[model samples]
Target: MSEKTILVWFRNDLRIHDNEILLEAARKADKILPVYCFDPYYFKIAADGTPKTGALRARFLLESVADLRKNLQALGGELIIRIGNPAEVLPQLAEQYTVNEVYHHREVAYEETAISEEVETALWNLRLNLKHFIGHTLYHKEDLPFPIKDIPDSFAIFKKKVERDSNVRPCIGTPESIITPVITDAGELPTLTQLGLDEPVDDPRTRIKFKGGETEGLLRLEEYFANNNQIAPTKGRNGATVDRSSKLSPWLALGCISMRQVYWAVVKHEQANNVHNTGMLELELLWRDYFRFMFKKHGKQYFAADEQTENTSAEKQTLFEKWKTGNTGIPFIDASMHKLNATGYISNFSRQMVAGYLVRDLEVDWKKGAAYFEEKLIDYSPASNWGNWAFVAGLGHDPRDNKYFNLAKQASELDTNSEFISTWLPVEVAV
Candidate 1:
């Protein structure tokens, strides 16, 4: 909190603007040292034996990190890249620079919080402090009307209470320029294959060009509101077409853009134009915040399936394989699944449909489906991805527990011409 040196560790909150940790470190320090760790654990196998991260996500991450590094450099600071656990790396960096405190955005999930505790312990042993700031959510937890545990059981209740009781704080605390510290090595950025992943394949069927980083994120946001003139994706559980939807998740998941930034942007758009769905976009952000709060309140239990879950069995495995490959015989579900497989992206509407089909229709375990999405989605946020899959499978806080999607009815309503289905699944098959 003084004019001493501070170490700012970059995690998911990659951007410098609206980054409380970076702003505080810059304002209080004579020098700032920023670093990002490509955790080996992330690139390793997942709990379900699936690759923890695939080529698409790994590539997007690299692009995001590179953009962060360039942004920091432009501000006169350099991003020190490393490949290791943050628990080991941060402590060493603190010792190397004699940092007064380590600053970073807080991560609410069990595994991330565990790492935070470990790093805090390691820093305490070195006589340094590990300080965390709120950068992920639109409203900091302290600003919420109720405590995380007291969060409303349903999103409607939660959103209503939050809208009435809470305020979205304006983002305006960043330093104009970062003061650079003397350093010999800035470190190297790793390629996808260098990070133990295969190269990504280009699919001509994919729609949105999902480039990562804050620049792209902000530009895409501007385009969505101004040039694209797109509104709400849809009101139901069907895959949204790319031409009119906002493709902001890929950058958001990487922390290239803050939620508050997006929220305020929508506010401005609504004031300037008569966009009917501006509030709907903010509703999506609220849902994201809900999942994060749920993780905070329930911890690991938020992921435990409440229904009968078949995690491992021959029949389940076969069903999971068929589902993953997008050959489950159901044309609508298959189309959505194929869309997900071919591109590391899918609309929220289709996501629910496919997730529900895997759990209720095919009778496969929800964890398997969730794990596969974790591996595949380019915009995969642990809080959003796992929480949503759980919600679909009736494992999370769903008022309508054990809800099932009528796939045929959903496709008929959303994909009236069967455009989305035929585009993803061209071959006709008997169902």
Candidate 2:
């Protein structure tokens, strides 16, 4: 009889290093097969009737998967690409290959949970064990100070407690060696056209100058830290930008890169440079972990508006059109919104301000704003996007729920000289 094979199902957690699921599969099975499914449901029309994964995100995902396939091939394994539902597809593949176990990263959002449950049921019927591990976050879910149920409602409290008590474990390295399997064959990756998306032309004026993949992600980490020597501080909310901030979220969100590899890279850089700017980069990673933990705690309630508010349903989707089109009449917000519209990416500061305008000034529901972000951002993570949106809407972790920014005020403050605003916001304002 042949050795039982372990199938690694790739979702948002794309990389191989520090991946608990991948590591476990390597230990228990003689041969490992990695699979990523481009589920049609993800590309389906959203509630607003816009394609959930727009052209820009679809293009990035296609490139990211192509890169992953190359990486897996280099490691003596192959990344199998499939379409259709995971619940149906995984079982069929398992039966064909006689796979004994399946491994994957855990997801907490509503749609993801539904798909995961369906996949689990299918696996159970086939007598295959479905194993899941926490891999997307910097801090492991099991190591958190509080249990999921006990997680605090407020982010600051959670951040403070985690900062005081929790520690980020070092990243796990890749398998010493991987064994190639020849039992099954998979098809080539579908192009954007195959995925029902037109090829997106890259905008020349985009601020984000990176591509998708573990190789490119690591190269960026090396390049960014090599040139600048500043470190970010944890406390004081000083709002200082650091050259040390790893712009790995886009790849990390898509699972094209691993958080452990990022952590390891940061540790090596700190040691080599012998500089601790203020543990700011590490602190940001901790915040990333905190948002995931929050999602684990709140579940779908994170997507709803507070029922106790009298004006809940009265909130109209007024500012969304302007915000989405980047013509909110406010220069900074307009610029950021326009930038995101054209390039499918925006800086973190701009993200918060534009989100603030929609939720606070325009009085739109945060979910609508979040859904729009979901449609546009290349780095869109349910945990981070919704978590941050809820925080800005005064619904998630902020103590002061009334966080609104006067667009003009923000324009003067962040772009006092008006250079940042003028770059995106045109001199001739649309009437």
Candidate 3:
């Protein structure tokens, strides 16, 4: 009899730790062919006239894929690397390996789902199955109290219901050994130039230089919660506005670490330290789940601008260019943009401040700002990025139609000493 071969297609979920697809594939298949495809589609130009993946993000992704390959290799498996549409590449792989099924984690975004469908169709034509698993969210979709369509439109209400009715499922353990048939060539990782992009110069001023891979991600996670294993609100030096986040977003965004792994770590820390500081981190994870579910529910509507924001006037366009380039003339807004442009990262508060400034103060199209973010943010995930932007624009699940931030008031409270402002902005641009 032919060996039962299952092809595990790696997407956003890159790590082997606590990954459902890997666990299931290992359990069911006689041999597993791990694959990572650098789809040229993701490297193409977006509607915003920027490459869909920027240099920094592309660098992060390459590192992540390389790390996955290393980990799989350590486990006696090879991560098959290919560059093309998954529909075409996967079908060819299925035939070449005589694979019985293709397994992957399902994505919620329109384009991702479309690609899944295309791959599914292609696999169907070859008389093979494309099995999908849900492993991204902290809470499994099946465990939710309400159905996806019936989830409350208000985040507060949704949060309350989920916190009351649902529990985060325990993580699946990593496989001890993965079995794969030997293959001569698994393909090679691509360079930035090969992806039609220039290498980004490292900016020394950024607070944290994030390296991709599960090893680095797990190390950072431990370092963040090292103090008494307590996850509490952090403060910056001299109480200046700094990103006090765990810095796990880039890894989390790419699925280097599973949400459940992070959640369980927080729970363990909370239990060990006998502290209640798990609320902040858990709440953030819940918000991430909410955004992903919202994308699943609303589909493409999250990308739409409201009637009031339909304008493409030159003045608004000019303001958008300035806002994105860190020349908004408003000190706080400019500083935020500068930080984002320089490092491809910013604090959640800074993101809110800048998004509010763009939508409320500058009155530019929220979609444009979101598109620029899609191009720039190294940690950009479809649901979180677009969902937060929509929330700030008052177009997402919230009680308020529009939320406004007082720029002067925010700067006064967060950057009272202007230290953050000085760090990112030029002397002339500094207030």
Candidate 4:
């Protein structure tokens, strides 16, 4: 019998290191083919007719895929690119290659779950086995103490339980070697112009500066930790630069980098430098895991405005619009929205504040706000985006509804000199 070929379908998990699916495929198969699909459906307009993946996100995705292609090639594997529905395209590829099995990282979001199901069904028809590995979160889904059905209703309870008991598994390294296959024919990657997006022009004013890819992501992790010593800050008022934060979210969001790799790097940094802190960085990573666990428990309902109950009100819609267009009449909230719209990025603090303004003060549907973030944010992840929105809307794990920031209070606190607000919202506020 000829060597069995296993197809490793790259979705959100783009990096080679710490990728369980890729490593498992290499271990089990004589030959492995790496594949990535640029689903046109992602770029389609929603019912509201807005572009689903806006320019910033599309551009970042393009960069990430390009980087992944390079990384895979270095590992003696070709990154196959396809444009279409994966359910249709993947099965066809499997049939062509006589693939015995397909492996991929599991995704828990509604659309992702739907696609995974569809693709699995299609592959089953061809007698090819489908294998999925948990890789997006720091904590693997299967290792959790409680099953999906038993996931806690409150985040604090969930976090405390996991931190005390759950172990974050070590990172999975790449295979020592794999036989390079002969399949070289692959489709072209979509250009910004092809995707109906203008080339991204660099902005001189923006503070956040980086591009997509695992290499850049790793490099950033090194620089931020080494140069900044951000972990030393005890309070939020330490005057640390924005880069003090991990800056790994964008890469992690796209799966160009794995959370396991990030966790290990932070551990190594602390060990080497003898630096210690209140585990703020670890807490942030836990937040990421918490979102994934929440999605696992709630499924599609997590995307809904009321996962626990159904109580839609008219006032929520009104507030959602104000939040979307950055015209909420609150200077700080408006500035954060404008920054997100322009650059596809925002600080974590700003994200919470703006989300709160829409869900609590403006009384808008959380779905609309989450969808808008999905369209605009370069670092958008279905779990984090929807989970945070639900928290703000008082529909997720939060014990109580949080209040939106008072514009003057936040402006004075976060942007003491009004620098961040003025930079994004250059126009003077109306009296």
Candidate 5:
């Protein structure tokens, strides 16, 4: 019998390390063909009237795809690139390449899940197997202590149960070399214009300068923790430079590196250096895992808003425009929005505050704010992003008092020297 050919569809899990789908495919197939699609659906204008995949993220994605191709090539394989719907392009590739099987890391978010479902059905119709693996979360779904539906709605409960019950799986091995598959063009990485995005302009004030891909992500992990001795602070929620940031989320967002790889890296650091504060960072990862499970448990309901939240800011368009532009007249919320627009990211505290401002202060629907962030954040994850917004909107995992911060108090503490605010403030705000 001739050698079996397998097609590995690259989605969020872009890295070669601890990649269950990639490793499993390498073990079975004679030739492994890796492919990534710059899906048009993701780039289209969002409900908030901005491209869901904006320039910063589009550029980061482009960089990541380029890096992924380079990494795969270094391992003696080529990453086939495509532009279009995965549901269509992936199946066409399976037919064109005579693929015996298709393997991919599964996604839990509704839109992502829907796309994967369609691709699975399409591949099945072609008489090829579409295999899905769990790589997005820290813990594999099968290994979870409880069924996804039975996952506790409250994060505190879920976190305690998981920490006691589950183990963080070790990184999987990468194949040194794989048999070559005959595919036509490797396909060019599309330019920003091709994706209907402008070239991203550099901004000096932004906290995140993260490049995409596993190499950069791992390098960042080391530099942030080991070199800088930068453990995550107790999230002071005061937007000081160090108080507010770590650029890890962007890499995690892209699946450029798996949560397991990141978790292990921290473990190695703590063991080598005898650090204790790494616990908080590890907890953050657990929360990332919790959101994924939440997405799995609730599906579309996770994105819904509670009916009680209202639009206090007159018209929907008027209030949203101010919120989006960071002209909300609340200096703290405005500053956070300004940083987000300029840098494509904000610290977790800022995310909570701004999201709360939109819901509680402006009385705008939390979904509107969530939709806006989805279009903008360099590290946007549907589960975490929507889950967080809903949590603030009193619609997610916890049913606590709706979170709201004193804008003046936060501004006073976060920008005491007037340095951050004055530096990044727009001309209008500054004047």
Candidate 6:
């Protein structure tokens, strides 16, 4: 009898906890091999000629992957690393290990899906199977109230329907131990310099210094829900003001912690504390889910630029440079841009404000802003980042006729003390 060896290809879903592919591989195969490919394509420059991944994000990813390797080693398994195209590397690794099947989490974004298709084609030629698991979203695709095509265009409608009709499944238990065949030469993790990015300098004013991996991700989750650290939003006349509460996004974006894990934690905390303050947190998770599903439904339309948008790209690029470099002369926009450049992150309110300023005020293309966010954000997920940008640009299923933000009005209202502005803006540039 032949051994059923399965190769678990780690992509965004990098953790050992509540991982469907890892667990299924453990059950179905005699020995499972875990692998993460540092696909060089992701490191390449985008159409805008800026890096597809900037230094800060590259650093965070490297940390996350390293943590994953360490966790796997502790579990008595080794993470095989390779710096090449997954489409080519996976097939090569499968043949070398005599793997019968390749298991991975499916992605919904355009380039990701294209890569998956390429890998699928490569695997088929070798007569090996590439099984894709849908585990990234809080609400699983199977559990959705409607099919992907039929999902409500308005997020409010989608959220209301899903909450009424669907249920979030309980998180699967983490494996006690992983059994693996001897891997003599699991490759080395790459450094930031090797990935064509310089080392990131730490900033003292960073709201949160994010570290990657399942261990760190779980610890942050515990700390977030701890009695002393229960996060509550600052209320304004409109509603809860924007803050990057909890700071779990980078981990969540990299799949160090699954959405279901976060969702259930919120549920337990609310139940135990007899408080309902976690609704906004849960809504964030749902918004992430909505974006993923929307990408599945709309394909590249979320990213597409109309003819007029393309023709205006030259003019937009000039203004975009000013906005990108924090030279916009608008105190609020400049401050937020400076923070983003320094720390790969900004508050949701800041993001909306800056994005609205760029698209509506400067009349730059929203796609440019989204592309730069892709390069800079440590927590950048294709669905959420692009979808939110599209929403701000009034291109997505935002039911609002006006997604514009009056930057001056918002700054006056939200930053009444101007402390946030003062902190981020340099003294030389301070208004």
| Position 218, candidate 3: lDDT | 94
Clash tally, candidates in order: 2, 2, 0, 2, 2, 0
Predicted model with the maximum TM-score: 3
> Which pairs clash in model 5?
310-363, 311-363
TM-score of each: 0.91, 0.87, 0.93, 0.89, 0.91, 0.92
On residues 1-431, what C-alpha lDDT tens digit does candidate 4 reach at each position?
78979999999987888888888888888998888998877888887678889988998888889998888888777788988899999998887877889998888888899899999999999888889878899888778888888988666777888878788899888876655467758768889778766665544467777688888888877776776555554334434223256667899898887888888887887798787652767777888888888888878766455644423555655566667777777876877777787678887778888877676776565677788999989998988888887776667656362322222233435543334444344333346
Better of 2 and 4 by lDDT: 4
Query: Which residue segments of model 1 deviate by more than 4 Å?
Result: 1-3, 46-49, 232-243, 274-276, 304-311, 399-409, 416-431
Please report, in order, the local distance difference test score of every candidate based on alpha carbons.
0.80, 0.73, 0.83, 0.77, 0.80, 0.84
User: Tens digit of lDDT per residue, candidate 6, span 31-87?
Assistant: 999999999999997665678999999988888999999998898888999999999
Query: What tens digits encode model 5's per-residue C-alpha lDDT throughout 65-94?
Result: 899898888888899999999989988888
lDDT tens per residue, model 3, 218-328: 998898789543345555555664445677889999999989889899888878878776576777787789889989998987545465637888888888888888776
Model 2, residue 95: C-alpha shift (Å): 0.3
Q: List clashing residue pairs in candidate 4.
A: 316-363, 316-364
Best by lDDT: 6
- Residue 208, model 3: lDDT of 76
Could you tell me which 10 consecutive residues in candidate 5 have the lowest summed lDDT? Answer: 401-410
Displacement of residue 427 (Cα, Å) in model 5 is 12
Candidate 4: what lDDT?
Answer: 0.77
